[model samples]
Target: MKSIDGISFKSLSSDLPAGLVVFLVALPLCLGISLASGAPLVAGVIAGIVGGIVVSLLSGSSLSVSGPAAGLTVIVLNGITKLGSFEAFQLAVVIAGLLQLTLGFLKAGIIGHYFPSSVIKGMLAAIGLTLILKQIPHFLGVDKDFFGEMEFLQFDGRNTFTEMTYAMQHVEKGALIVGIISLLIIILWDNPKLKKYAFFKFVPSALIAVLVALGLNYFFRISTPVLTIGTEHLVQLPAMDSWEKMVNQLSQPDWSAFKNVDVYILALTIAIIASLETLLSVEAVDRMDPLKRVTPTNRELKAQGIGNFISGLLGGLPMTAVIVRSSANINSGAKTKLSAFTHGILLTISVLFLSPFLNLIPLSALAAVLLVVGYKLTKPALYVNQFKLGWEQFIPFIVTIVAILFTDLLIGISIGLAVGVFFILKANYKTPYFFHKEQHHEGEVIRLQLSENVSFLNKASILLTLHHLPDNSEIIVDGSKSTFIDYDVLDAIQNFKINAHERNIRLHLKNIPEVISTNAH
Candidate 1:
């Protein structure tokens, strides 16, 4: 029940500028994700538009943008292959949307709350690191493929690392010169003092870099060995001259596959993985929100569902609330959902009217921008900061990072979570007994104080003492300071109660609270 009316026109104006910034950032992503998802590039742009517009209108988030995500690339790839046609894949996307909508209705927005803070931070840091590692090739001007594919060994037979090595081996001076110039401009523009220069302050640095790079590549004809990202990396618009051609590209769901068990399994798989990714992104984005706003998890699911549904219908890839775009929105200083909506509008309009122009943007420039972004995410400062927190936190954080670097996202997170749990358990093992006061023996009565949290681990000590108690002795089991008692030790005490009665040993249980129901007394 949040209303957009409360956000003022002045605020909207402020947000518009930020929206424009986000739009520029999202432009390449829309195409990049589409390229990653193996869907038509136009479909990716369409999803971006829908996510920006439709999801923005329905969303509870103030600044998050909905779009096809790099994370969903695997799902989309598998979906299309299984469905047999792009049209059929579109149907699945729609179905995924409906599922997300249902999740929102269930008030599942609380899903973002449960992730451990350490793991979440690690995720963002990992993504940042990954971005930096992946963009090096692009920055080097060797763009043989579009962005978003996670495989290190790309179809080109080079992984991210190999590509970097290859680029270094046969460097293109023209692409290199343009890239250096673009990087320099961005680095200089980021300066606090120089940033305030009104003439250059508000302009998008990435766009500038791209224009400069393109001009250098086109007119100067500097023959550097570096490769340039071409139209294949950019989004291509659907030939909309005839409605029939558009329909031909649209995918439909396979009703025949509906009866297959794999369909249900795939649906569930999509639901779970998509939900986990969405929840994780939502958590990360909220952390970036300057206003300290929180989103409802269920509402997010619904918005995602709606986004997926529409994207599928149009032959686009499925979407979630992506962190890269969300972070871009936050970084751009967006004030409300209007920012997301405006970006969507820009996406739609740009694809329709600016297709040719957008196509001219060099992939290297986009890679340069991403290079900066990735550096920020995985900056050495992040590691230093986490290390200062203590070894307990730092160890898991580093483990997660290394795991992500060597393996994939899910595996790395899993390992980090495991290590974190191990640390907790190890800490617990150091303290086995509590409430310590030595046993006291008066003329006739022996008094023993019970320890706090007398767990099974401590049972051996207490039980051994009980068995050695002198015959005909009067004993008092004092638990006056005990806060909690474990069940295994309780069983031992109850047995002591029985044995004491038979031994003609008078035993008194102090702190005479009736034995608390089923637990240790």
Candidate 2:
């Protein structure tokens, strides 16, 4: 074991095993995301390597892992088609990186802070559901659509439910068997007794399951040829011979597309979305850290920006800090960022030397791994807990999930945010001021105390209260505790003041600036 910069060499054993686990988890995902994004398979692998190596080295987060996020699959696909070619889209990725760098320098990473807790939780749950739904087809060997594509409506015109129907009709017995066995292995590995053993602790369940599935499929191919998993149901990495061939495989960005206005727009969009996903993932990962380590958000943004820049130059997809990979890294017993870097190195080595072996792993096994991941994210407990938090919290959470399931991630979150804001406004209107009424010898005495920092959202409530004052009542509009009040609210009060004489009410204002009547002005 060795130690460097607070990362102990003693933990190398732990880190190495964890890295291998993350590498296994990332392999199919990179290929799937790339296929979904309409980019070449090599592009996804390149982004995965860059994210694990470059971004991890530069990020302040100890456990957060970076990769080609599934969240960006839809955006990347559209961007590529709209921009005409993959090479042109790569230029947009470069510009997006530069824009992300600018945002980091400007400290815009704080944008994550404004998202409601409900909305964030909702996003997580939505993604989990998406994973489970999207992977079902792959698990059954229905390869009509790209694997790992999470959008509700797929590009091939098949939605989530429709894909399940298709999968049912086109079920491959070999894949179904592998997927079921792999899922069983994963479930069994989670047993506390099994996990206590050194071999089980060091070796990841997913890796073991995959290897077992591979052996089973290989045996079936020889013994029961008809039951063998076909090429469409397995991983398909581009095999390389020498370093020169690998270098030749790298794609270059089309600089000539730089002048197109649409390219810049796509760049800005990618930068914004990628930055948001990174910040959200970073926040979520920090919360998951057992040590409760806090990550520097701005620094993370800058790291991702630099990563995307390098990836684009080398013909890779856009990169972001992904919650799935990061959570897998932590759960696999990673101690530091070294695990992430190790994963990258493993990915590179696997691509260079073990591509043929990787190609033999069945997609069903990978889908089983993702199914477990998705189940963890959208566990029943999460919904129960959210429901207990009251409607104000639960509504947005549920709404976000449904919207994301029906529409898309960004749109779903937007809808959830809008609903959350409506609740906030309602609460503000209900509690902006306290109205106390007392009966007096002369008339009813009404005392209204304004809350601090009252805003225009309270205007309607204030107007209604003022209008319903009993005839010949004494009303006091007090702003002594308020540091600031919106002009709309103030104007409503002034109008009430002007009408007091006609309504047979006595009006008095305290510590509130008088608003001149329009006729007087």
For lDDT, the strongest prediction is 2
Worst 10 residues of 2 by lDDT: 1-10
The per-prediction CA RMSD against the true structure, in angstroms, equals 5.4, 2.7
TM-scores, in order shown? 0.80, 0.91
Q: Worst 10-residue stretch by lDDT in candidate 1?
A: 429-438
Cα lDDT of all candidates, in order?
0.69, 0.87
Model 2 TM? 0.91
Clashing pairs in 2: 1-9, 2-9, 3-9
CA lDDT, candidate 2, residue 44? 93
